[model samples]
Target: MIHQYQLNGYNIVLDVNSGSVHCVDDLAYDIIALYQTTEKQQIINKMLVKYAAVPEINKAEIIEVLDDLAGLKKTEKLFTPDIYQSKAFDFKNRSTMIKALCLHVAHTCNLNCQYCFASQGKYHGERACMSFEVGKQALDFLVANSGEMTNLEVDFFGGEPLMNWNVVKQIVGYGRKIQKEHQKNFRFTLTTNGMLIDDEVIEFANNEMHNVVLSLDGRKKVHDHFRKTFDGSGSYDLVVPKFQKFVKMRGDKNYYVRGTFTHNNTDFTNDILHMADLGFNELSMEPVVCAPDDPYALQEEDLPQLYGQYELLAQEMIKRNKSGKGFTFYHYMIDLEAGPCIYKRISGCGSGTEYLAVTPWGELYPCHQFVGDPKYSMGDVWQGVTNTELQTQFKLCNAYARADCQGCWARLYCSGGCAANAFHATGSIKGTYEYGCKLFLKRIECAIMVKVAEATLDSTATE
Candidate 1:
């Protein structure tokens, strides 16, 4: 399958299956759109009539475009057959080698973010913290189940991981102490609301953590709307300076300031820019996940504005990049030359199988998003995953498994999207969230355009 679009004054055609990207003139672009659907003679006749007034119009040139497309087809770069359907079945039989665990260290938070998916980090259950004993067992469980994989990932996540600071430190120390003995390398990450960042926390994180995620929703007004302290006041003023200091000391380390945008702020480009201006080079802003009836839920009317925002953000990124003041937007990062492997391209994030979330009490869920739901509970860390049936179901969840994703141009880019999102929007994990799908497609388009524009600029400079 092929997808075509005109962006930033360039006509782009993307061969969906083989991942071939082509830049073509208007004549070739229009011809390729009909190349697969219309008869060759009919296409030629239609082009002849359509371009009759043009002095350069000719039957020979139209046929040349067809010839080029045929050659691309012969090379298996265009209209490549769907070969991943059968492979989707193979995942169920593959041995489970758990590679990562998102440890819910703190099931409590200092701030009361109204729009929080985790119900203020309590996961709608209890406000508690994971003990060091539970965390150590979680890490051990990962090592035992990881098979021959030498590298494993552990993310310290919470309502606010720093809220359980001592335990977080002990767990990191334990991971380091045991890594050499097991011949395993544990890469740790921390995600926090930035309410408790101190000099010591920053120093330890820069030394031991692979990456850190700081939660700040861009501008003060946008962030303060939903994220607030227990006293019902905005926490924006309290956290921004701390986050800025943490990031400043972080130097070249990996980090991102993650934010969420709701209907209250559909024009999130301004938020992204506000954060960029604050000296945060790495940033991401995601749409808030809420029920349809929720006041902040993005409606159908918000889509057009959101689309415009993504385009505006992409264009702004290009301009900033040209001036050497560019900041990275997580969603806009795409590597066309080398990306995820074919298996990864088809399947969702290895949740429930290769990756699991450990709750404060050691219960295992598919991932953090599914933490509170008892139905998704796989098992505990000490006992390991006992629910093989649920595990197998997630194993079979792939791009090919979703009928809605089969014909989508952005299917491989998102790998059928988040399973939790699918389950929440629809009744089943195999279903699609049409609302998120639309926004995602727009982002992918903008990402591609930005890459194309950067290449064009670089080529011109060298000339």
Candidate 2:
């Protein structure tokens, strides 16, 4: 299969199956489009007529390009058969095993960040915390529905999970108690905003949780701008020291200093540099996804700068690697070397399939992003996914189900985009936002460039 688009004044063609990219002229682009359906002679004839008025329209050159494309096709580098289509998995036949769950432990937060997607922890609903009873029952539900899976994952997520510290600890202890009896191991993760991260919380997380995600949006000024306290004060001073101390205490454990970039901070490389300067080795900076009209939301004009920032970040990563002090940047660590192929990409991270999120009230959702949204609630902890039809819908919602994805080379990499983002932007899981799509494509291009640069450096050093 082939996907073609014009980007930065260049006609780019991507061979989806073979993972080859080519830059071609308008004639070659048109010829490729025509060759998909028409005969060779007819394609050539049509191309000649289309470029008939142009002084550059040389019959010999057109034939030569056609011959080159044909050679590529003959070598199975272009026009490869759609093997992935026939191999798409049937969601109905998938196992009903639950492997991962994101438990919303706290329904409130200490900070009132302006761009908070969770509506400042209330989740657009009444403020409440998960009770010990509900947390224990959620763990029981996971154990019962795990279906022979020995290793399970549970994430303590919330407007601020640390807000309900007691229940979080109780659930972890309960999970440990039941592990031996159920013959299943539980790996816990906590995502916190760093406000309530005291010594005890840090110690408990390091000892019990497999990983922790600390929320701090890059530099002090930038982080303070959007992620602030209820009184409109910057949180950098409050959290940075705690984050540094926690990382020091939790030495060598899996954790990441996570941040978000918005329209106000498209040039986000400086934020990353500040984090690195603060001794954070593991970092994840994600773009804020919000309504277009929101002043802080990333818009079309912001993409160019964002793409440039990615390129700059990639270069910095390469420099750090060469200097022998390489740190993992979440987006830059895309494993293109051993990544999934089209077949495996058909289903995404198994949101409604292998993964589910439980709210403070024991209501189930596909993920944390959909926790407060009632339309997406698949089931409750007691019932164990009562909505099989909704699960099936999510299961079947793959690249093949989207018309736009069918022609995208990055389809496999993105797995037909995030269902939550899709639902939020277009009111359907099968839909995709155009701005997000553009940003995604640009990121893929940036990733490819980074990988190529790294490979070239390695080759040169070896030589």
Candidate 3:
């Protein structure tokens, strides 16, 4: 299968199955598009007619382009077969070992973000915080079920993980103390709203956390509109300085100023640029996920604007890169040469099987998004996952398993999309969220274009 598009003055062709990307001239691009469906003679004749006005594109060049495409087909670099279909559900047969756990350290928040999917951090439940005992047991459960995996990950997540700062520290300390005994290395992450950030918090996070995710929705107006204090005030003033300080001190460390874009702020590239201009080099802004009826939910009409925004964002990144003020966008970070293996791509995120979320009280769910839902509650930390049926459902949730994704060119790139998003949008883990899929495909397209632009323009611009 092949996908082709013209972006930013380049005609790009991607062999979906083989993961080969080619930058070809206009004549070759047109011919490759017709190579699979039309006969060789017919394709050449069509190309000749289409490019007859151009003196450089003649019958001989058309025939040569066809021959080149045919040679690529023979080498399995173009129009390759989908040989991975048979192994789509191979994850079902493998032993499930836990590798990561998102611990809900605090289910209470100081801010009342109206668009928060977690419902103000309580996750649609009563406000609570994780205890040191439960946190320790969760760590123990992860170690026990992790099999022989040497590296394990634990993310301090929340309404605001800093709200339960003491317990979060204790859990990290306990994990570090026992990692040597178990021959396991624990990599910790902390995601916060910046309400409770202080010098002490920054120092400890810089020392221990592998990465920190700081929430800021770009410009103050956009962020303050949805993310506000319980007293109905904007948090933009309170958080930005703290976040700037956090990132300034976190030199050379991994962190992202993550934000969410909704109908209210479809032109979210401005937010990304605002954050970048604020000295935060690493950034990400995702589309808001909410009910169809919700005012902030991105509608079908919003897609066109969002698509343009992605392209604009990519173009801006290229311009800034050339100017030596380049900032990294999380979604645009694609390593085409050596990405994740096919097995990882097909299986998607190992949510239920290898990764799980622990509630403040130690209840387990496939991920943090599924927390508080009784049906998705797999088990408790001390007991481990007892809901094998749900686990199997998630195990079978892959690109090929979804009927709609079978024909999608971006299927492998997204790994069948997020299981939690699928379940929320369509009421089943195997279901596909068409809306998210459309947005995701656009993002991938722009991401690939950014990569191509950087590689193609870097040397020339420098020279």
Candidate 4:
């Protein structure tokens, strides 16, 4: 939250998370504690009342406390987290920005996973894999257009990206080339189904890519029920053995475990623990999307139950996180674990800001979900990343693009939830995921409560 303060002769503003401060619209020193008068308190209080329009009572308290304390004052007008967040998107110095690009390598997958979001199983019209040539071409465009990316990240996605291993290989190869040419540090990751991620792929990935997102929805029974091979045999056993083999790749650093949760895979908390028991450290989860082909589905009222499940899942993770064991979350993963979200301007989950997509034919798109939705496709592969209507919807379709998330203060925090998911599940971006959005806000509120509680304890300790 952005809060403003006046102390001594400076107007102090702080971005509470990063502790970045500004004084008189210029860079000011950050302060962790504020009760030590040190002669700067009186001037500060008066300044707050004058410049910040601090509440009279708060100003009186500040004035009373100013002469006696060094770094403490009660200025109501000071910028706090909520105040700063009110202007999050417009804040000039906010530190979140897109640091990586999730590039879809192949639109095709080897197996048809029931809970698959990309609608990969259906061989509908124009649904083909991105050829090796088009893959290289897209990378070329990305590298050429990466004007100021110092630490660029390339995230590979697919039906089962390994189906087009050549595409993955070339992107890695070209990513290296770009890293060298641009003198930047580049990182690579792949989200795969682990079917063909054999020794050869592991070696290349370990050497070249830093992380790999391997999907494991639940325990064997649950996973196999949805993810299956062409013959309808369960892919769970296949994935488990391969995952075991992959983790046994002789490296102490285990990075290839990702968990996805669908509505069918109930027991949200157990699923989290289950993944941890599987020796995986992190997981990303979303509600399962059922296309016309999905056998099971909700009757509309089931969304609240799913929302409750999400809350329970979040609470479980928080418990595990506090248990001294290593666990990671996927949606708000970086914000919770890493030092604040680096990529700014709402979590641009493929909504046109930094980098978009090029279909197998090289047509630009907002994301892979649209590989089926032709209206969102820009130009064919031969053309560049065209700023098409789909692209606009990707960013500015505020109604569908942002929707009720706009009314939310956490809107920027969660990047208005996933845009594609918004369209797919809600029927339009204007639609609201009341459950998903509220769950996120609840978690954010939890963080706030924890911070407040910590401050209270610290105060008692000092006293």
The lDDT for every candidate, in the order shown, is: 0.90, 0.83, 0.91, 0.57
* Per-residue C-alpha lDDT of model 4 across residues 1-463, encoded as one tens digit per residue: 4544432233444444343333332122222234333345555554564556535535454454443322322433232333333343333223223344556666677777766667663324444666667767666666566666677676777667787788778777876776776677777777788889788987887787777778887677777777888788888877877777676673765474665555565565566667778766656655555553465554356556655565555455544555567576665353333444533433345455455655556666665565557666665445654544544444443321454654455554565666666677678754665555655665544343233323233222112
- Residues 412-452 of candidate 2 have per-residue lDDT tens digits of 77878888888889988888867778877876766655565
In candidate 4, which residue ranges exceed 4 Å CA deviation?
1-102, 121-127, 248-256, 291-295, 298-324, 332-338, 341-350, 380-382, 388-403, 425-431, 442-463
Q: How many residue pairs clash in each candidate?
A: 0, 0, 0, 36
Q: What is the lDDT of residue 339 in candidate 2?
A: 69
* Model 3: per-residue Cα lDDT over 63-149, one tens digit each: 888789888999989999999976878755475899999999999999999999999999999999999999999999999999999
All candidates: CA RMSD in angstroms? 2.0, 5.1, 1.7, 9.4
Superposition TM-score, candidate 1 onto the true structure:
0.97
Which number leads on TM-score? 3
In model 3, which residue pairs have backbone atoms overlapping below 3 Å?
Answer: none
TM-score of each candidate structure, all chains considered together:
0.97, 0.84, 0.98, 0.70
lDDT of 1 at 398: 83
